[model samples]
Target: MKMPFFTSFILLVLITQIAIRRTSYKIESKEADFWEKERKANFTRKKPLDNLNYIKIPLDSLPFGKLDDDESRYCEKVIRSLADQKVVNLTGFTNTDLKLEYGAPNITELTKYDQNYTTLVTNLQKWGKLLYDAELYNEATTVLEFATDTGTDVTATYKLLTDLYQNKLTLSDSEKKEKISALLPVAEELRSLSKDQIKRLLTESL
Candidate 1:
């Protein structure tokens, strides 16, 4: 039995729509399954910090197995002195006393010690800036170089050094231009700093 033309066309359209709907449903299901699996995998993975066994060690005990007996003894004495000062208010002994008692070197002696001393870097950077502000360019350059070479913001140090060479000291105009050109990259990186900070740095450096 042959159907009417209109009925035949209607049936063909309905079949095409159903087939498209089925294919779309399958694609959506696959995407949903993929995302669900990804979420599960992510949840199962260990976090980076959680997997770090070194963090389990005490902060004072970090970089373990790196220190020798003398270094370890010096570190312990320093820690003890700090703790005593904080807990017992024992402030009679000067830093020199502590160094003598621990047989540890003083600042000058320890200048050649491990370059990773955060406190030393802080002090040197502070002193460097003070000297720079006092118009002592040579001394400031030496201190700042020590601080920056030992890993305290090399970019800032370079910028300051360049400024000192350009504006503060007696460099020739050609030399000043050369130094400024050399420091352009460092300045670009530090351009994100506040205008006030940039001005303060330039003022001290010059």
Candidate 2:
């Protein structure tokens, strides 16, 4: 016997819905699998250094001698052991070695290192501000000549430097007045500023 028209229509709709649900489920499963694989690959490719402990040694504390091979090997072993245990503090060893190596009543090597870094940063800040104010953008690049690595404020410094170079030729008296006029609104919005902030604003204007 032939099926009634309404029954056929309902069966056809049920089949179509089932097919659509199956297709959707397959697509979702494929996406889930792809993301899982990507996650696993990223985990596998992570740097070993990220999980390893690093030993910071003052330059003076490093044992210097072509013949002290055994001592050097021992130090390397100690560093490896600390890395394995994820204990990064090596200040005790570094301090002891500093005394042994320097043999003088003076500032520790680590203190000197810190002072040098502080001096560099201070000089960079001063020079950067002066160059920004003087509109001597080309000369300002010298401030970052020794920058070996990027840091929090370093990118901003670089950006300001680039802007300075791009706008160096445009700093004639009339142009200066025009540029200052344009920046007035921004200065109003940011009413208070440190020396560095003012330098940044001027550099960015370039």
Candidate 3:
């Protein structure tokens, strides 16, 4: 004898329910596996500080390196005299792309009035890197802003600063507002300069 219509209907409904449950379980398992892999990958990535290998060099290399023996001796004396001056430690900045300017020595005497813009830009960049390495991202951004204000073409620097700011979960609302306020003038200065003038400034400084 044929099965009753209601019995056939019940069997069909139970089969559909079982199939739907299996599909849901499979999707859940796949999602769980994806999250686990992402977590492990993030944990294994290298720390930023460990990757930086900063090397300190004289602010003006050619001027110092080309000195005659006697002049070199005099320069050395000057350097020794100013040795106690404090300079920001840039030990966390990578040396790659820093071919021209690296960190400055702790010697204030070497800096003079009417300093070149490169010197100014280099110092600002170093300070920024030092601050970033120390986890003072807001301060780092401020210093890099100074570099941008001086027409240093700090697009890459700004991008990096933006990344740091976005990831800075520890900062309070007031602190972030203060940083933005400080950056406004620098942004205005950058906007005021013509592209040619910025290039000229860089050329003269270099």
Candidate 4:
């Protein structure tokens, strides 16, 4: 038996719609899987101290940031003090990265000026992870953005924050592209700088 023309047309339309839906679902699923892989990779590495240029501040009778106590607590206090602030101005400290290179504070009297660059990065990572777990991507982004200014050692924080912005935040493709382009140079610049150079750039930015 021959089908009527309208019936055949309707059947073709339904088949096309099903195919479109399946294709769309497959594309969305692939994207989700890729993002998931990226997110999981962040946890595979050690936290902030891994790739940073920090010297562990000694706990030799220093009233603040005693290392024997909770390291995270010490970092948390440092981070809070830096809230709503941009990169730390190196001018605040006596320029001594040159002199301190020879003898570490363990022997020399440089303990008073040894900078704990890792602490802020560590705290930022913790806070960003907390905010992300709580589904506060915007807040996480804000915290991570502040961390970026503090130093380039915030690779982990920056990585996770970018993931949140890309996957969780609602942004157009063009806007996302623009942001990534702008951020890549900063990351590269930070990576290239020595500890002293980073301090100089950060202080000059202020």
**TM-score of each model, in listed order:** 0.31, 0.27, 0.29, 0.44
Using lDDT as the yardstick, the better of models 3 and 4 is 4
lDDT digits (tens) for residues 165-191 of candidate 3: 546536666664564455444444553
Candidate 4: segments with Cα more than 4 A from true spot: 1-78, 81-97, 100-114, 191-206
Model 3 stretches with alpha carbons more than 4 Å out: 1-115, 130-153, 191-206
Ranking the candidates on TM-score from highest down gives 4, 1, 3, 2
lDDT of candidate 4 vs native? 0.52
RMSD, one per candidate, in order: 19.6, 19.9, 19.4, 18.4
Best by TM-score: 4
Q: What is the C-alpha lDDT of each candidate?
A: 0.48, 0.43, 0.46, 0.52
Task: Please give, for residues 92-141, the per-residue lDDT of candidate 1 as tens digits.
Answer: 33333334333333323323232224344444555455567667787666
Record all residue pairs in model 1 with backbone atoms less than 3 Å apart, i.e. clashing: none
Cα lDDT for residue 61, candidate 4: 22
Error of 4 at 38 (Å): 43
Q: Superpose all Cα atoms of candidate 1 onto the true structure and report the RMSD in Å to 1 decimal.
A: 19.6
Which of 1 and 3 is ahead in lDDT? Answer: 1
Q: In model 4, how many backbone clashes occur?
A: 0
Clashing pairs in 4: none
- Candidate 2 clashing pairs, residues 3+ apart or interchain: none
